[model samples]
Target: MNSLSAFHRPLGSTGLQVSPLGLGTVKLGRNQGVKYPNGFELPDDRQASALLDLARDLGINLLDTAPAYGISEQRLGPLLRGQRQHWVICTKVGEEFENGHSAFDFSARHTRFSVERSLQRLETDYLDLVLVHSNGDDQTVLDDQVYPTLAQLKREGLIRAYGFSGKTVEGGIRALEQGDCAMVTYNLNEQAERPVLDFALSHNKGILIKKALASGHLCLHGEDPVAKGLELVFAHPAVGSAIIGTINPHHLEQNVATAIEVLGR
Candidate 1:
């Protein structure tokens, strides 16, 4: 896209080659109580479209969204139309945000309903990937019939791959063992979850690095903490991609450049 060095790789054994960086859409929808050091107004349609175009131009093909991400799904439904072919959309199930609180429903019926709603909202017949948005009780959710429901959806062709965006090392590993991918945090401030990536590498399951920059907190001191964080995550052979949400096009471009540098074509 932007004449950047190539840095695409396979997402586990899913047969889909994806960019090493994914654009997270939480910022595109929600701005309340965000963890960023600075706050900004939500982008309107024109700005959102331009941002997506810029991401594509920068060789970022992955987009991460969730129902809990405020109006993200509804907003992207139209914004992503006609450009769906170029993105690997990864939306979530099991968590819904309303009136400033999160609620979980991972039952088979609700899971099916959520998938249907996501498909409708995203204006797509199918999703490239889906992750269980754990409410910190990762194992309990899986045990309470979330994973099985998603597995059924995979068989039904609603999602190409399914995994867990887990909060614990054990839960992440368990998700990988049973599912196609595991989204975990692996930044400079946190290395306790590195075992999850190791397990994914050994088991050939996909590993998506969440909070690779600690949700923007990592940039507080260093001149290039984003680059430093990406270097740390991409150094691991297990990492499939790092999902970073930023409305700033310059930051996205800089991130892509940093990723290519760390990955080294």
Candidate 2:
């Protein structure tokens, strides 16, 4: 298959096809130092806008963001107004940011409000995908509020698909068991999530690999360690896509080239 075709994969049973390499927008919104290394301050709006344009031009169709990412959806939505239809905009609910810290809020009412607010910020009538952002605890939240709320949104057509962006392997596994979720994002460097990856693959769940470079530590010593690590993850039969955050368009293009080279190998 060609690079674009290789990049495209089924997002669970949602029937949505997205690129294998996605753009993570937290850095673009000026929320750094959370999950990434050397996370220093983010770039200004003009630079972020240029990066988004570059990503689209390079065929990146999935853009992952979260409300906790501090003004990401608000800024990205307006910049992507003309090209919104060309990409899959993925955002999360259940995690809120205050004072630059993230907190979980999975109450049914809060979940509903989060989705609605995300829609408003994104300037879209419906979300391409909505994930319940979990911080490794509160499995009950998924059972009690998240699942039902997501189902309701899907039924109402306010969301095309829903899933979990979890911090733990067990939480991800549980989310997959619901069988209604369209995709799951998990830390790939930690083997703890391997079982969840297997389950998702077996069931055809959309699998997006996060932290594939282990928060930039994989290549800390240089020599393209991150590229090698990503090669392994992409070769895995289960992983559908990997989200890499970078401020420079040249770095993005280099990573894409590396992925293409590794896939060919």
Best candidate (score: lDDT)? 1
Candidate 2, pairs of clashing residues: none
List per-prediction Cα lDDT, in the order shown: 0.89, 0.77
Instruction: Please give the lDDT score at residue 154 for candidate 2.
Output: 92
- Separate clash counts for every candidate: 0, 0
**Weakest 10 consecutive residues of candidate 1 by summed lDDT:** 1-10
Give per-residue CA lDDT, model 1, range 31-118, as digits (tens). Answer: 8766788888999999999999898888889999999999999999999889888889999999998888889998889888999999
The alpha-carbon RMSD values of the candidates against the true structure, listed in the order shown, are: 1.5, 2.5
Flag clash pairs in model 1. none
Runs of candidate 2 exceeding 4 Å displacement: 1-6, 179-189, 220-223
- TM-scores of all candidate predictions against the true structure: 0.96, 0.91
Per-residue lDDT value at 157 in model 1: 94
